[model samples]
Target: MATYDLKGKRALITGGASGIGLGAVQAFLRCGASVAVNDLADDRLTAVVDELASAGHAVVAAPGDVGNPEQAPAMVAQAIAALGGLDYLVNNAGTPGTARPIATDDFERQDEDFWQLLVNVNLVGPHRCTRAAAEALRATGGAIVNTTSIAAFRGGGSSAVYCATKAGLVSLTREWARALAPQVRVNAIAPGLVDSDWMCRFDGQDDAVRMGQPVPLGRTGTPTDYGEAILFLAAGAAYVTGQTLNVDGGLTT
Candidate 1:
């Protein structure tokens, strides 16, 4: 794992209670950054904060629904206030809205309400947080790293709606990079085959083996696999912006 001297830095991670978000949380905290873990108001959110706090890490719970327009910016503001200021924002909050992958032609499942929900959290949610945090980040010369997905680059993911939102995020990453340039850096990561809680399953006896067989690396990826990448983009990679790093284990190759 990559390491950095983040003793006085502060960060905010949305959808941070589990999976890649949790991975980033542990990475930032391990490197000495104070973090505000954002998620929906629920027991899982409280449990994560309590666990991290008990471990002596500087973590506070910033619970709200990223899918809710009013709650999104409000949560970012609260997180910034609690952490004193923000040096980094990881827009990792998103949902596939379904456990199973929806076919490209499944327009019924990809209805108006479904698209709106995905767009709200996966696309518009980051915009809300970035808009709220732009000034703070600019003051500190900080950066924003969005948790996009390999779905944005390829034909497979949870659903067409999910892919559309993630792809839109990639466009936003570049646009925001230009908009926030010379001040706050903007970038993204497109993870592939990560064995996170977001929903990857197989009925095979060895799901990991079954799922990872097609990848050149021959294994599924874990949260830690992405945590390292997040660490680099957040605290290192000073000159890199507007790019989406593929953190897959050679899956796309």
Candidate 2:
């Protein structure tokens, strides 16, 4: 894992109970930063918090559903409070909007409710969290890293709605970077075929293995790969903003 001089900084990572979000939390902690983790309120969230705390990492639980507009701001505020302030915000929470991939021709499956869910969670959710954290971030000249996906550019994801939402996030990242200029730097990471619990729901272990065969890296990405890129945006990429770093191991190249 890569290291950085993140000591004394404070961060909040949404959907941080596992996968890339949890990996970000661990990365920040390893670099001596205090991190507040946000996820849906549940036993899993509690377990993650306890486990990290037991290992002597500076982590706190800020649980709420980002899909809920009302809950999003509250969750951000709670995380900011827990961390005393916020220097970095990782908007990693999102959903595929289905248990299985919905092909582009599956128009019947793309109902109003499905579109609403994907938009609310993947698009509006990040906006809500960023808006809520803007003031705190401005105060500290902080940074924001959004988790988009290769689907944003390459297309073909778990659902058409999922791809659309991530593409919207790419646009939002550029716009937000402009909006928060000179104080809070905003950027995004586009991950590809990450091996995680979330992706496993759509692509089984065997599927992931097969998918990795043609990649330049000869393997699927890991949460730590994303974590390192996220940390770079937050702590090391001083002149970088409004850009989408494709952490796909040359898959997009």
lDDT of 1 by residue, 45-123 (tens): 9999999999999999999988888998899999999999999999999988776556656766688889989998899
Cα deviation of 187, candidate 2, in Å:
0.3
C-alpha lDDT of residue 108 in model 1: 69
The lowest-lDDT stretch of 10 consecutive residues in candidate 1 is 196-205
Model 1 misplaced regions, further than 4 Å: 200-205
Instruction: Write out the backbone clash pairs for model 1.
Output: none
**Best model per TM-score:** 2
Predicted structure with the largest lDDT when compared to the true one: 2
Per-prediction TM-score: 0.96, 0.97
